[model samples]
Target: MDTELLKTFLEVSRTRHFGRAAEALYLTQSAVSFRIRQLENQLGVNLFTRHRNNIRLTAAGEKLLPYAETLMNTWQAARKEVAHTSRHNEFSIGASASLWECLLNDWLGRLYQASSNLQFEARIAQRQSLVKQLHERQLDLLITTESPKMDEFSSQLLGHFTLALYAAEPAQMKADLNYLRLEWGPDFQQHEVGLLASDDVPSLTTSSAELARQQLSPLNGCTWLPMSWAKERGNLHAVADSATLSRPLYAIWLQNSDKQTQIRDILKTSVLD
Candidate 1:
């Protein structure tokens, strides 16, 4: 019934010596003995068998050991959960580095404009990491080019976009131009394999479109990038006869979350939809 009494009981049980337990608990030996007496009286059980110098638990005390441990664990967890809820109204979001570079940043900007008061944390990770975070409920939402196959999560078709090959200069000398591979996903990689020569592997490969663009913008190299990203910068033009690749973006969240309604509302009205 009394958590303090349980704490005293646990400490005394651990040390098996009243004086040692008191030292560990930063209390006087008399105070520790009084607590044990009070606990025994309340429970109507003699918890410990004390000889001249030896101490051992009684049968009733042994029976309560497991339950006391459980009670302490549950109490600590409750305190942590309550403190987290009281300290912050937080929304944690995660996505692949490619998605963040291509489109999710714009979506985040829009979300900030729509709900200025919303406190959110954004993480850029690989697809596997993001999916793991979602399953663990560490991430409230995930945005990605590919939807997860797991049924425990709900995904929505946020929008579709195109990726086109671009270069800082025209491909007059194809042999001289370096290629930067922007890793969108397996699907994009498979699609790209057919478009290049058998011997034409990339000079550099990057998971981020922004990083790819940074290299391409100055080096006159060719790389595929989202149309939205390409349009904003100058001195870049689509390579002649290059195929435009179409990709879909999805917003994924846990299916049975307590914040399900709030997440749906935000997704529905947010600019990402």
Candidate 2:
């Protein structure tokens, strides 16, 4: 089967509208219909049921979805592997936006400076999306604050960072302060519950620390931030009685990865501090 046909099928399945799929794939509507027909003919099964504006996958199409995704990911990985030269290598790394901002950006910079022939593809996304990519072999490594509890992958502790409550006024009472919540991770949330009162609701919630800091003001709110980051900003003052939390940063990859040595070498240069 031509991979392009599978690609078109996947796109159509995702959009559920031929016109939308065509727009996304940069093809004519007729061309999109032709590809779907060709795929259905090849498989000898009706992949979709078309009823006016409603388009839905048939049973066969639903069954093929997971397999199609796996095939596409495998093909992409194979192409990248085959394209590598003797002196140059490529790797794909993923992390959350905050992780990139707080830690991995510097680590990536160090990798580029030290490894002349190494090339990297960096993806910033939420933890769930990054984990999915890692599981599908679409990412070579994932950097996250929490370790995945799966046996199919291995995680190594890169370093630790401290998060502390910071406010515009150092003496502001916790009850009177407007709280801005940052989604650090599940473990951090568990730790946070003990530090905060049950009725203390966040006025604003965000996943990016930078955004949290930008939105904070003398009269607006206080939030948990990296101790190092908060100290650098002269306007932000540490809360006197707030509890400090320590978070471990981790580098995760497939246990049976072929590029383990290279990944290890790259991680050696990571400096979270």
Candidate 3:
């Protein structure tokens, strides 16, 4: 199977338009169409439903999406491994955006300093997407708040972080201040339900703490943020009498990963502080 055809298929799926995919791929629209046709012919299934301007992946295409991503990632890793002339080992690590901001970003720098021979590719994504990539062998390690309960993977408790309600002003913490809810995971959700009033409805909800922080000042809203982050920025202050939540972070990786030695070495260097 031609990886180029798969690449074309992926781009088309992403953009949901042949012309746009062609433009992005730097190929003619006719060439993109031909590649899709070739891939469909080889697979004996229509990958997409074409209806004027509306294009969508068929059931087969939906099923093939992860496999295609895995294949492309594997191919890229293989090419990198083959092309490298040094003794360095390359590993891909993934974490959620909030986790990267609060924890993994600093840990990654320390990891590099500690393990000079190891090269890392860091990706920030939602936990579900990261888990999918880890399952598909696209990612060597994943850092997340929730540990996946799968037998094929091993989960280790990395550290814990405290989340506290913060606002630009103490007065803004009370009354009709816009409440921005950060999705910290299921545990935090349950804890939040207990902390907040039943009638209190969040003005906005998002997965990224950074996004919530960005919107906080202008709205004079209160949101749960990592204590470390809240302390760093002088503009934000902790809400008095607000409940502080402690969330555990975990490092997850496949149990039988080929990069076990390298992964182990990297894990040793990870420091949450």
Candidate 4:
């Protein structure tokens, strides 16, 4: 199938008029009609039903809409990735800001040691944005706390980390000690609500654990943090009953990707090891 025909079909679908689509594509109206006709002939179905000036997509056309757009976007992304590969063995990765600061830095070191010649592009985004980018083929790999249930993706365990409450001093039961709420997701919220006093409120709330860490000393506050991170700071100590909080990390990638074998090996040998 000619990609141009699909492109023209999408343009017509967007504008809902062949003449306007032709104008947008810099093609003659007749040429646009010819492409649509060619596509209709090849697919053995009428794409659009015409009634004078009013135009509407046939049932067959409506069915093909999503697939057509996906094909075009995938084609464009493949072309861009091919161009990148020609220049260098580039791998694009994305993760949450907290993950980047806590984990991805070490993973990058592992990547460099595995293949010094490989080029890397790393992005820090929330999990939702990372999933979107991964689906669009904009990111080759993701390091996240939870596995994506999408069929097109594959995930592997990257080990687990404990999230424990930490403060500038030893655990204190005082409500006025300046509590900072760290957003760790819904599970954390559910686990924490029962632990807090009914009228107690945090002095600060933030999504970034690093920000929480920075504020802990200044405000003389307490917040949940990964044990590995918290242990490094001498002034901070774990709060009472914080040992139960732990979550697994996952390394996810597009299933059956061109770099699947290489990524599998890299994750197994370098990062996970």
Candidate 5:
């Protein structure tokens, strides 16, 4: 109930000594003991086991540790959001680096003066972690080229994203036909018998599409990249013969969230139509 009492409790928990906690909080040792006693009284639980000059958390205090920390974290985040609402109306969003650099900014720019508080924090992470944070409500939206299939999470498909295969030098592809390289992913690892007639496998592979794209330029390795990223590359040239790899991307969020309106506007403006 009392945030100040909780803060003091946290300090006491930290030092495991009333006197030290009092020193940190700029309160008298007696004052610290009194506050903790008041808190224990309010909760109907003993939080500490006092021993002469030593103290340890009671069983109750141990259980409350996680909850108390959660409360403080929630309070801190709420305080931040309230402050931001008065100034920027910000929401923390997460996405992969490619989405943040190219797609997110483009949409957020026109999001509006009417909704001046509507600012987004684009947090970057790999797919699995980003999806986890989204479910945890630590992130408002996840922008990427993959559609997450979790039942609890939902999606609004923007469209299919086409990826292009490119060669380092124009001559490499023009010079050879056996240069097919596999994109690293569980499904993509298998050479579709139709796509490859050769008994030989890919020359090289890497898990990161971004890295695979980077490797495409200097080495004679074949790699695929989102068409948007690859179309502008100065050195790498697209293989017109390759099957255009198009993935359906979504501006995904947790189901039944009211924040979807704010999320929707961002998606509409940012994703390629």
Candidate 6:
């Protein structure tokens, strides 16, 4: 299928103007119309209802919009995957901020320096984004703290992440009305460690775990950060031992793509067996 033609259709759908869509594509209006005509003829369906100054998708075009997006994403994923091994020895590994700082680089070093053909791409993304990339067949492996189980993917317990309370100085707030900051991931809000509406400490919310610490500032506040980040930047100190609030981390990859030996070895050595 002509992906560009589908893209042109989408642009026309968005702008609802032939000339504007042509300008966006760097094509003349005549060229745009011809492409649409060729598409309509090939599919035996009129994709648009053309009016004087604007265009609207016909029922037929509207029906195909979702499929077109799927195809485009699939094609892009295939292109990325194929070029991965050829242009550069490539594997994409994804994680949230916790893993990004904790162990992501160690894995990259093992993969990159061990083989001259190897290229390591590290992705910092959330669970849904990582799952989407995996669905698109764009990722070789993914590590997340969430215990997401899918029929098509294989998951193993890589390790556990333990979080602790850290502060630059002893908190000055009343013991009952304490403020504890924590990240968005399992480090803080999991049902097992519910700090959001706890009777113990009235807490603050943030989109990033790092932001949680920033909100704490020098005030009588507390936040749960990855132990690794807190230790090196000694401005913060752990107020309590962290054995209680730990969550399991998983090393995950799609089962169908599991046969890649290089990726398998790298993942085994990096996170899990």
- lDDT (Cα atoms) of all candidates against the true structure: 0.80, 0.83, 0.84, 0.80, 0.70, 0.70
TM-score of each: 0.65, 0.65, 0.66, 0.63, 0.57, 0.58
lDDT of 2 by residue, 82-196 (tens): 7774337778898877777766777789899877788898898888888888889889998888887889999999889988888876676666677788888766677556445
The global Cα lDDT (0 to 1) of model 5 is 0.70
Candidates 1 and 4, the one with greater TM-score = 1
Over 1-273, each residue of candidate 5 has an lDDT whose tens digit, in order, gives 987788888888989989899999999999998999999999999999998978999999999888888898899899987886658756777766655553555555665633555766768777788888988888888766667788988788877667666776674442354344533233444434444446765555543555655666456566666667666556667764566665655778988666877776666564663
In model 1, the Cα lDDT at residue 178 comes to 71
Candidates 4 and 6, the one with greater lDDT:
4
Better of 4 and 6 by TM-score: 4
Candidate 6 lDDT, tens digit per residue, 77-143? 9998788767876777888765666556565676666666767778888778888898679887888
lDDT by residue for model 1 over 102-221, one digit each (tens)?
A: 677777878777766566788988878888989998889888889779999999887788888887776534455677888777766787664457987787888887777778756767
Q: Note the residue pairs that clash in candidate 1.
A: none
Candidate 2 global TM-score: 0.65
Q: How close is candidate 4 to the true structure, as a TM-score?
A: 0.63
Lowest summed lDDT across 10 adjacent residues in model 5 is found at 182-191
Clashes of each: 0, 0, 0, 0, 2, 2
Q: Write the per-residue lDDT of candidate 3 for residues 60-175, one digit (tens) a residue.
A: 99999999999999999988777772456678899877777767778889988898887788898878888899999989998888877899999888888898888877644445
Best by lDDT: 3
Model 1 shows how many backbone clashes? 0
